[model samples]
Target: MARMVFCRKFQQEMEGLDVPPMPGAKGQELFDSVSKQAWQEWLNHQTMLINEKHLNMMDLTARAYLNEQRDKFFAGDAIDSVEGYVPPSE
Candidate 1:
């Protein structure tokens, strides 16, 4: 059976992850409160951030920046978008 959680990002009850995405208390919090869909959204946003900013994951500063963004994103706070990015018309 699938697990359920009250996804903080989406603000709705949804399917939960099988395990925390990372180590630490925050990871456990995400596993309990974030949904699979919201997590996938963050992955996409993180990818965009990485590409747009030319972020080098191996660099400590870059990793720290991403971590901050991840926390804000999951907390339903404002997150910066890629510079000069234009969303496609619907």
Candidate 2:
């Protein structure tokens, strides 16, 4: 599971971050530009589904959302801890 920090500003949202511009903002570094784009698209779909379900507890819901999406990526081996907030390791 993962979480979206409430502290994150609107412009800092990861909406376009899956594949950050080269030499620009780095995101999803594990995936190349093309791969990251595809992954982000898939992530959007999953996020839509999660939002549709409507969760009252955002933290728990976000974590589950990320984990669920991770399953679709690497057999669920992607361990992005959305349970806490931290700057991107990159």
Candidate 3:
């Protein structure tokens, strides 16, 4: 059976990641509290933010912004959106 966690983002018990997404305490925290579905959603949103804002991952400010956004995302707070971008019709 897959590991399960009480997802901070979704506020429900769900399937968890197989391993920590990164090293150290923060990664461990996420592994314990975040679900796989929420993590994947955040990754997709982060990628959209990077592409839409033309953010450079090598830049400290950009990384810091992403970190802030990530925290807000997991906390169920409002996050920055890609301005002037529209989703495709299904």
Top-TM-score structure, candidate number: 3
Q: Over all chains combined, what TM-score does candidate 2 have? A: 0.34
Higher-ranked by TM-score: 1 or 3: 3
What digit string (tens of lDDT, one per residue) describes model 3 on residues 1-90? Answer: 999999999999999999999899999999999999999999999999999999999999999999999999999999999887899989
What ranking of all candidate models by lDDT puts the best one first?
3, 1, 2
Name the lDDT value of residue 38 in candidate 3: 98
Segments in model 3 whose C-alpha atoms lie over 4 Å from true places: none
TM-score of each: 0.89, 0.34, 0.97
lDDT of each: 0.93, 0.42, 0.96
Q: How accurate is candidate 2 locally (lDDT)?
A: 0.42
4-89: candidate 1 lDDT, tens digit per residue: 99999989999999889999997998899999999999999999999999999999999999999999998889899889778899
Pairs that clash in candidate 2: 1-63, 2-63, 2-82, 3-82
Better of 2 and 3 by lDDT: 3
Best by lDDT: 3
Model 3 scores a C-alpha lDDT of 0.96
1-90, model 2: which lDDT tens digit per residue?
Answer: 222221122222132333343353334432322243445555665555555554444588666665566454533244333333344587
Clashes of 1: 0
Candidate 2 all-Cα RMSD: 15.5
Question: RMSD per prediction, one decimal?
Answer: 1.4, 15.5, 0.6
Q: Which ranges of candidate 2 are over 4 A from the true structure? A: 1-29, 32-34, 73-90
